[model samples]
Target chain A: MQITSSLDEIRSIVKAAKKNNLLIGFVPTMGALHEGHLSLIRQARTENDTVVVSIFINPIQFGKNEDFAQYPRMFDTDCELLSKEGVNVVFNPKASEMYPDGFCTTVVPEHLEDKLCGKSRPGHFRGVATVVLKLFNLIQPDSAYFGQKDFQQTVVISRMAADLNLDVNIKVLPTVRDKEELALSSRNAYLSETEKKDARCLYQALIKAKDMVNAGENNAGEIKLEMEKVINNCKSARIDYLSIVNPETLEAVTEVRNGNVVALAVMIGKTRLIDNIILMVLIVCLITLA
Target chain B: MQITSSLDEIRSIVKAAKKNNLLIGFVPTMGALHEGHLSLIRQARTENDTVVVSIFINPIQFGKNEDFAQYPRMFDTDCELLSKEGVNVVFNPKASEMYPDGFCTTVVPEHLEDKLCGKSRPGHFRGVATVVLKLFNLIQPDSAYFGQKDFQQTVVISRMAADLNLDVNIKVLPTVRDKEELALSSRNAYLSETEKKDARCLYQALIKAKDMVNAGENNAGEIKLEMEKVINNCKSARIDYLSIVNPETLEAVTEVRNGNVVALAVMIGKTRLIDNIILMVLIVCLITLA
Candidate 1:
């Protein structure tokens, strides 16, 4: 795998690959690649001729009170993992290169970004949308892979691409999780050993809700009530929000439709973990009807 | 020139043209094409292998009291002009195509946008930026051109393109004016023959300011006062703003800089005319010191 720390090198490498008729697939990430990131890379590897991963901890995405300073940065391990994953290129640009001096433009995704994660963290998705666009232009990929763990982010980016007419297809793969069912996140490193085990409740609660959703119980309110019950039982967990929402619109839903997604975020100790389960059962029902 | 009301068709045409190693030069306009629009097309032809012009009367840019309804529409004449100028394609997508049933996306340009035109017309440049970005993506131009008549818009768009790292180069060509020095504008349709003659004072004032700055005048305030004097003297002209400031920063400057753009907006009868002249007097002095 080739690694470059400059924007020029990243552009040139991607440009050359593009000229050779290679299908470039990009997975943009903040450094400190975890299992969730690897899952995205694996998907990119499956669909495209080349996979290009960017590991820039976009400074714009970090809120003032967020853990930007203490955010994980395991560059050596990240490079080794990408090399082993058979990734084609890794763009690890410094902050200055990603954001040159006197840079003063922002990309804001509308409506889709104003709820969920947006309400909890203001200007968070603005930074996300802006950096995602910059990286999309730099990579000039045929497709970009994103994990469904960041549900709102995936929705916002998809909307940005459509609205801006960006020539990139966003492919959302299922969320990756540990064997215990806790959603994989880079912030999982912030949890103590005890907190780590306690974090398992987040995914367990999601699984419980999914089973309820599948068992001819389509009321979103009923699903959320069951989810809250499971999450409240965890000793180290503080429920941020357990919402059964229409994933496409990211709005709260009363009835579970075919494409509706049940997603939630919970605070296990200090680390935030999110998980989602699309009603795949309803998708099967639609296919049978068709 | 073939004109289609579908964005998808335009994209395919541009893509095919690009495959043939043709460089696209785009000029986005709100139809009613006049001498001003022709100047842009003619300049674009000189620089690119093929030129693409877009004509859509963007509703978002117009305020409640603005002339959106009264805005001229000369479609047949506009298409004939493009054919005469050798424009390869005219992407004339309808309002429904560009903005589907429930379109909810807006692009905001900060700092520069909030001054001059933006202050007078709130959400104006945001509309401009959003549509321009959408057009740029649909056309996939090697370079996009804008005239200096709308000086603030050129600055805002150029800043947005740089900040977003959009892969298209922005060319800001000088304003083409009539013999009487009235800056070419489609809104010149609003002017009576008598009113059009008086509009000449807008450029005349800018010329007076540029001449003064070249004669070793460094104080911005002093230059602005002299400019207002020239415009206020005209019978049909009303002073809206005449400010001599730093070009890059747009801040009110007390000291002279090596490169600065002197910009202004003035009311000529009912037409809101904007014009500018980039002065090189400071550069001459700085070069002498070097």
Candidate 2:
């Protein structure tokens, strides 16, 4: 329930927790807490003795013309929700605390950064990786919780942790969604009632691709085409990218398999929304006992 | 000293030490122990309850045509020397162990990586920063030691530590030298006896720049020219770069001032050596007793 903006205080608090042999779990978020973020915090609360959540609206992660200025900052409501979740601390740092003047070092994930979301928003993952690393250092958590809503982010951070030999377990929970199957994101707040209804196509498109794979349609191009058609059914929806990719590598898959992912990004009335579903080919094994 | 090649073993050992409230100090090196490395280890030993040294001749840090293959790695001798220094542990991981297949993450320091030694050996600091970060995470040292002979490297790592908010303290110790004033390096093993004597010119040139700065020479260009002349006295020495730079920024300085570093790299026969000296301006403060 303690809210702190000072990095030193957080470090000292974490240090004390460590001295007492308490397992720490962390959830890093961008402040406008949604059901997706709450799911991550709830998971962290169940798993560790100490739970720390960071609310940082990272500016560097946004493109020059992106909606950084318009990003929601509902601190009071977010803190109240976290406090109800039995969270130990909420780290709400100012922009200057996270990125002071003359901050120059960057953590870069090669090749993985040049695809999908990275293509539209250049330098986005670099900014994500850098701030995440700084937060990781400051918190020194035993494990960090992330939602699968940002699938590529989970992959990138997992790769970064493995590559750097960071002593952190990156646990990813399933994506939380509304009754309409629209993935819950803070940006969901930007949509009008009509635009929000149209945004449901993103998830619908992903489901369509998943259904195609389930029906033994292995051609990735054909699956993408069908998914695009599903998204285009919404008049206001404009497709950014429709991809069938290897889940681990994030590389485009020519022949869709059991674990391939169908991800899509669409512009719904000036608000960009992304959604994805893993293509699962069920192999039910039947056993007869004599 | 317990020598470990397994990362898990080191992690457990450090974990046990942490449980007992022991402070860990670390020194990372490229095997072939010399006075420079010992000085760092000795300092680490005095400061912390446990000292861990890693001997990794990182291949990524070397240029394509550089001496990565021929780099001296006297493991037995290095172990013997470390044991004499009261070292607690020596971590000697295989390259594959450090960088497994498909390792794609890299730590890059912008602007600073393109100057001085980086100009000749591109991607050197990136490799250094990446591996050093890996070591820091694995060892989880309270303080890590480095020799000041690699001046720009210290600056790059310090910037990375600050930028990333790494928990470990980066301690830079003075570069250890031989009787002839030649900076101690494992690569010195590559030089012939005559070439070794000639290598002394590297440090000698740095001294000449120091003397020039001390004698009221504020022009960086003029100081570099004088240092180049001293280096040229050794016919085998071919200057790779001779310049004065701000210690923190690593940018070439047009006007020298106190704490500016005069750094150089030279190709003596087939072996490339580097050395630097800090230019300090004497400021006499007159204290008048009233």
Candidate 3:
């Protein structure tokens, strides 16, 4: 696998790939690669002739108070893992390369950006959308892979690409989780053993919400109460937001239904962890009703 | 020249052109073709193997009270002019095609968008930047052309392309003018013959500003006053904005200097017209001082 830090080199490579009629798939990440990132890379690998992974710890996405400084950067290990995963190219651009002087333009999505993760971390999705768009332009990928772990992010990016009439396709994969069902994230490295255990409450709450929706509990208020109760059981976990929202619109739904997403964010000690599940109410509710 | 209204077809054609190693140049317009647009097309034809022009009357750029509905669009005449200019492809997408239902994303340039024309027309630059970006993505041009008559627009777009790391080069050609020095614009069609004659105040103001700077007038305030005087002399003209600013930053300059752009917008009867001239202060000031 070839590792490049320059934007020009990546474009040339992408241009050459296009000349040869190779289908390119891109996986954009923030470096500290784990099972979640690997899952996206694997999907890209299986789908295209060329899989390019970008490890940019985007500073603009982080709030002033967020853990940008503490964000992990394990480049050597990440590159080794990607090489083993059969990735063709690894694009690791420096902050200066991605955001040169006089970088003033930003992609802002209205309505969608003001909800979910957007409320807590302002300008986060703007950063994500801008960098992702830049990567798509640079790589000229046929399709780009994004994990469903950052559900709202996936939605925002997909909407931006569609609204902007970008040529690339956005493919979102299911969230990868550990055996304990804690959603795998690069931030997962920040947790202590005890905090890690407590973080499982996020996934547990999502499952409980799913179970309630499956059992004909349609009231969003009732499901949220039950989900919050699960998180409250973990003494170390502090609930940030527990929402049952329409996955695509990210709007809070009064009643749970098929395709609605049950999502939650919680603070386990100082580390913030998020998890979600899309309620397949049609299949499960149909089976129960019958 | 081949005219395609479907975005997908244009992308495929652009893709094929790239495959054949042809350098593509793009010129995006709102279609009532004039000398300014023709100048850009001619430049594109000379420089690129494949020149694509898009005629999209973007609704998002115009304020509710503005002339979006009345925006002149002469497709057949536009096509004839483009064919004569040797443009390879003409992309004329319907408003619905470019902005279908659920089109929610917007590209916004912060400080630059709020100044000059952006001040008078709130969402104008946002619409221009967004549609131009969509065109760049669809065509994937090697370089894109713009007329400098809309000076602030050129700055905003150039800033956007640079900030977003878009692959295409943004080339701003000098504003094309008639023998009377009136900047060519589709909006010129809206003017009555007398109003059209009154509209000459815009270019006349720009010339007066340039002449003032040439005659050793260094104060921006003084030059603006003289330019505004010229526009005020036209009975049908009302001043919208008249200022001397840095050509690149669009920030108002206190003193006129080499490279400062003297830009103005005026409403002649009901039609709004804009014009500008770059001050060559050094040559003029040196001659005056000697």
lDDT of all predictions: 0.83, 0.90, 0.89
Over the stretch A1-290, how does candidate 2's per-residue lDDT look in tens digits?
A: 88999999999999999999999999999989988999999889888999999999998899999999999989999999999989999998888977887678999988888888888989999889988999999999999999887988988999999999999999999999999988999999999999998998898888787777778788998988888788888999999888888877789989887887778789999998887777887776889898
Judging by TM-score against the true structure, name the best candidate: 2
- Which candidate number has the best lDDT? 2
Decide which is better by lDDT, 1 or 2: 2
Report per-candidate TM-score of chain A alone.
0.93, 0.97, 0.96
DockQ-best of 2 and 3 = 2
Considering the two chains of model 2, state its CAPRI-style docking category. Answer: high
DockQ of each: 0.62, 0.86, 0.78
User: For model 3, what is the C-alpha lDDT against the true structure?
Assistant: 0.89
Tens-place lDDT per residue, model 3, A21-73, is 99999999999999989988998999999999998899989999999999998
**Which residue pairs clash within candidate 2?**
none
Candidate 1 residue pairs in backbone clash: none
Clashing pairs in 3: none
Clashes of each: 0, 0, 0
